[model samples]
Target: MSETRPLLEVSHVSRVIDGKTILDDVSLSLERGDLKVVIGPSGGGKSTLLQCVNFLQVPDSGDVFLDGQSAREMSRRNICEFRQKIGMIFQDFNLFDHLCARDNVAIALQKVKGQKKALARQRAMAELERVGLADKAALYPSQLSGGQKQRVSLARALAMDPMAMLLDEPTSALDPELIGEVLNVIAQLSLSGMTMLMATHQIGFARHLTKEIIFMEAGRVVEAGPPKILEPGGGGRAAEFCAKLAQVTGR
Candidate 1:
């Protein structure tokens, strides 16, 4: 890839579900190690946008590019390979109820990456440790707290050695107290230079860590720019929305 090229690009993407347009000609780009935050009200299409970027929900129009390669042009097998290189973290902790934390993280490594059981478990442990969950590795999802379960989810995604991550409100399902723990891990990932595009309602956290914020409304990117665009009196849509959010949350 050329030095000027983006690591990930979503070009003119649109998605329609049951005649309702969920996305409308959305486009964005992420350079290697860049972190971009997508913020909007519920039902504004942030999740669908992220899903399209990862090809989890194929767009009806437009294409996604990774490392200068077009996803729409790739074969079915190639699309699967493309997804493996980009991790998706969901709002719910999607760990297997029957698997312990270690096995939960190791399962994808073994099944998807074709690693041997022992090596997969080894890598799983390292990732669990990275997320500060090594001590809980023996625990099953049923025994873990909401925060721990989310950490296990993070470990599972990290075990894949993803080049970039798309997080869709990863902390949304957690309790207020639990939100911080997961946010802390995400903060660590950002500081470690992980390429991430996150859709979140944590405006304060997003403002502190992200250089750019993309504000979506009614299936369109209404505003996008530096954190300054969200500052008081900045006059951007993002700033106005955030000011209202602050009034409600009292933050």
Candidate 2:
């Protein structure tokens, strides 16, 4: 891929489910190191957009290009290879209860990358260190706190050396006090230049760190701009939504 080209592009993408429009001509782009956030009410189509970008939910129309390769064109086998470059982190953490943090991150490395066991473990440890979780590497998911489990999920995503990551309400499942720790890890990733698109209700959090925030509602982008939309009387429906969010979140 050319350095000048965007790392990810969602070009006029649209999707419908059971006769309802889920995404309506949604288009956005992320540069190589850009960290963008998506904000909206529940069921506003933010998660669907991320899924389409990762091809977990294919769009009925339009294209999702990752480093200039269209997801639509990838053959079934090629889709797996293509997805290796796009990491996804979900709210649930999704770590296996049976695996220690180290093994959770290493299994995919060994199975998918064909790395030897020792090499995968070494790399997994490094990713854990990057997320400030190297000390917790031996713990099972159940033994870790919610924040630590989410960090492990981030570490697992990072282990793949993906060019971009899509996070879906990553902190929504965490306890109130644990949210900061997970957000801190994501903030560190942003500062370290990991390209990311996050769908979150954390309006207060995004104001300080994200490069851009796209406010989505009713299956379309209502506002696509900087974080200033959170200011009082910023006045569009997007701004109003953000104000309500700030009041409710106390952020």
Give per-residue CA lDDT, model 2, range 51-105, as digits (tens): 9998889899999898899889999888898789999999898998899999999
lDDT score, residue 149, model 1?
92
Q: Alpha carbon lDDT of residue 94, candidate 1?
A: 82
Candidate 1 deviant stretches above 4 angstroms: none
Candidate 2: misplaced stretches above 4 Å?
none
C-alpha-based local distance difference test score of model 2: 0.91
Taking every candidate in turn, the Cα RMSD to the unseen true structure, in Å, is: 1.0, 1.3
Alpha carbon deviation, residue 196, candidate 2 (Å): 0.6
Clashing pairs in 1: none
Q: In each prediction, how many residue pairs overlap at the backbone (N, C-alpha, C within less than 3 A)? A: 0, 0
Model 1 error, position 167 (Å): 0.6
lDDT of 1 by residue, 1-251 (tens): 37799999999999999999999999999998899999988999999999999899999999999989999999999999999999889998788999999999999899989999999999999999999999999999999999999899989988898989999999999899999999999999989999999999999999899999999999999999998898889897888888998999888
